[model samples]
Target: MGQAGATFPQSLWDPSFLFLTSGTSEGGSREGLWGHVDQLNRTLAQHTEDIAHLRDDLLDCRAQLAEQLEKNLLFPQISTSLLSVALMYMEAQRKPDPEKAIAGGTGD
Candidate 1:
């Protein structure tokens, strides 16, 4: 009598330990438990891989967006400076009499 057979009585009164000794005789129940464990481990590994890939993609998107924002922001400042210079040049050219223009007089 092995330890498994000795620990469990031949009666069905001990349902817990009875399954351990009385089964398909081919260890089918034990194999089922191991199969479940393997499936759970595979699921965990797949989820971990998916999360890592998503994190890397998010970081890459952030870097690209930041670069685009920097370029967009810098473009407006350059455009504003160019417009200001053009306006200043136009105002300087329109002023026929500089002294009168500064004094706010029509030169009458």
Candidate 2:
């Protein structure tokens, strides 16, 4: 085989493609293959864990947003109800003026 690729510095893409081929064994040892496999497994496990955490965070954020949206949607109605209740309470607490009641008496 020609050493055209080996003559220069190894590019960034070489290692990923090289290790999969039969002729490019890492020092002609099976240990290298197992090492790569183990690394890949660890990476996969870490990614799975990260994805789970992200999903949980997303769900929590969604719940919070839903709650805030509910509050926002009902704010006007709640305020109006409270104002009406306050007005009703004020109206109930007001007493009739004594002078007006006496002056408006029937003259028959």
Per-candidate TM vs. native? 0.58, 0.53
Of the candidates shown, which would achieve the greatest TM-score relative to the real structure?
A: 1
C-alpha root-mean-square deviation, each candidate: 10.2, 7.9
Per-residue alpha-carbon lDDT of model 2 for 9-97, expressed as tens digits?
25536664444434455434456667887999999999999999999999999999999999998998999999999988987787767
lDDT of each: 0.78, 0.75
RMSD after Cα superposition, model 1: 10.2
Candidate 1 C-alpha lDDT tens digits along 12-99: 5766544653456643476675677699999999999999999999999999999999999999999999999998898776747878
lDDT of 1 at 28: 42
Score candidate 1 by lDDT: 0.78
lDDT of 1 at 97: 81
**10 residues in a row with least lDDT, candidate 2:** 19-28
Question: Model 2: runs farther than 4 Å from truth?
Answer: 1-27, 84-108
